[model samples]
Target: MKWSIVFLLISVQVFSQKIIWSDQQKLEWSNFKSKVKTMRNPDVVAYTHCGWEYSSTVSSDPSVPVKIKITTIFREDKSWKDPKRINDYALLHEQKHFDIAEIYARKLRKEVMEHIKTSSDYNKNFKIIYNRILNEYKDFQIAYDRDTQNGMNKEKQAQYNASIAEALETTK
Candidate 1:
């Protein structure tokens, strides 16, 4: 018997060089490949673009199980830093942002697994969950920058760094 599989991918529209999040790999100054642009707020020294994407595959045969893959990615081409102002502290802050994206990607994977077991409408439910998680992830990123004062507040930056490290440990 020949079994068929259907694949569905959901992701942002950007087509750029991306690096998958990995525990063994950490972000470096070289990873920030985009040309630095003047921002409205001159205090902004760097930007890190990180996010998650997922794809689902369903087999035609009943015996074959459905599979879902979630990936956390760093957009190298879309991230940038001001060379004159960049430092280790600022790099740590940016790394935390990427770490947060990985945490959310794991959360989405868990949700998809649980959801697939219970929901009959996989695609619709998956989209809903994906959107909700994406929104939450974006909000958290904004809050991180705000609470840390864009890494200028050393104390808050340390707190966020610790929090993100703990989350990364527990989520995996």
Candidate 2:
């Protein structure tokens, strides 16, 4: 008699530059140290790309605890800038974009914590919660860009900044 073990392979484009967000460690233009892209589209002088990595694990025993984590990542290589045109104001807008990512991470943590009790089908439930939070986060990010007109609208920018700050506190 013999036992068999199977492995699943998943291919993903992994970025080497991954910076986890922290309140004490504020993002700076220096942190945007990745090489800038040569194809500098005039409409898009600078970009701050962000995302998250979520994972969970379960033990063979049903009584074993399930572990889960959601990490907010800032892609330095993907996030580019045109120093010739990127100004302090533009940098603030980008920083705010990163802050928005942290906001969602905290919110996701809260949601996941609440559902930890029901770990019978952790993967399915986790996906539902993760996707919902991610969708909402994307929607808010787009709305921020549109409402502030990419930070050109000073009034709207202030409002968004204030709102994001407040949201950060609550999520914590």
lDDT of 1 by residue, 1-172 (tens): 1232222121332334788899999999898989956356788889998897777676555445567889999988889999999999899889999999999999999888887643244644878988899999999999998999899999999898889999999988
| Cα lDDT, all candidates | 0.83, 0.79
Which candidate gets the maximum TM-score versus the true structure? 1
In TM-score terms, candidate 2 sits at 0.82
Model 2 weakest 10-residue run by lDDT: 1-10
User: Where does candidate 2 clash, by residue pair?
Assistant: none
What's the residue-level lDDT of 34 in candidate 2?
57
Clashes in each model (backbone N, CA, C under 3 Å)? 0, 0
lDDT of 1 at 93: 89
Q: What residue pairs are clashing in model 1?
A: none
